[model samples]
Target: MIEVDCPSPAKPRVSITYCTQCQWLLRAGWMAQELLSTFRDELGEVALIPGTGGIFVIQCGADTIWDRTRDGGFPDVKTLKQRVRDRLAPERDLGHIDRP
Candidate 1:
């Protein structure tokens, strides 16, 4: 019998903080949905946090994965997924996203 290691239903939570003043709720919601759908098995929860001053940050626990204020740009879906995958399942392959 071949055994495979499947992702557990419970894992670290992810939070996305977006600027309410900047009207980034839709963008943040879209990213949250993408992350949740992609890593449904590996992730426990995805939270959307509203803020001000053009803040757009994505965090897994205390670690900051992406910050628009620091990175000077918003993260694309593939890039965000890759970062999440790196922390959650480093050994897993990301297929097309890994392609050059």
Candidate 2:
């Protein structure tokens, strides 16, 4: 029998890349803070990468969770939090976000 090792699911490392040319640091920082506070135990880390040309992207590993250009606008904190929670902890309920 060939034994194949599979890695267990660990806390996800989220990356939020925003445009430096557009001075989007404060916006990105707010998003990072929200994610950190909401997913304190579920996230490994949140990285803010500087870019140019009105770019803002959020990723979990190589998977793109949210993209500003693609999504059409900035994500609201509650919505963004739900996205992170869905990716990292699908079964974990986000109290207010999950509620109607």
Candidate 3:
């Protein structure tokens, strides 16, 4: 289950994930955060960001407003978001930081 903070029905609980790829972070008992950018992550294919702390806040609410419309059949959105969030988190947690 996803554990998060922020007690508010309107506000989303922040979810921080270590890294699924990084054995170290995963070993530390941290789960990767799922992400879905504002709209049109790129020119074509939907981009995915890393889920560490900053990516899209990134998505601590399990599924944010944008996620509600996301195609549930595809898990890539979450995976990609996590990847981007992890990399961009150092930059003051830029919300909706586009995936490279």
Reference-based TM-score of each model: 0.87, 0.86, 0.20
User: CA lDDT of 74 in candidate 3?
Assistant: 23
Write down the lDDT of every candidate, Cα atoms only: 0.90, 0.87, 0.35
* lDDT agreement of model 1 with the native: 0.90
Which is superior by TM-score, 2 or 3?
Answer: 2
Q: What tens-digit string does per-residue lDDT give for candidate 2 at 1-100?
A: 9996443357678999999999999999999998989888988888899999889999988888899978889988888988888788889988878898
Better of 1 and 2 by lDDT: 1
Q: Please provide, for model 1 over 2-77, each residue's C-alpha lDDT reduced to its tens digit, 9 standing for 90 to 100.
A: 9965544568889999999999999999999998888888898888999999899999988899999788799999
Query: Residue 9: error of model 3 in Å?
Result: 16
How far is 42's C-alpha from truth in model 1 (Å)? 0.6
Regions of candidate 2 where Cα sits further than 4 Å from its true position:
1-9
> For model 2, which pairs clash?
none
**Whole-structure CA lDDT of model 2:** 0.87
Question: Could you report the Cα RMSD, in angstroms, for every candidate shown?
Answer: 7.5, 7.2, 13.3
Q: Which residue pairs in candidate 1 collide?
A: none
- Highest TM-score among the candidates is held by which one? 1
Ranking by TM-score: 1, 2, 3
Lowest summed lDDT across 10 adjacent residues in model 3 is found at: 38-47
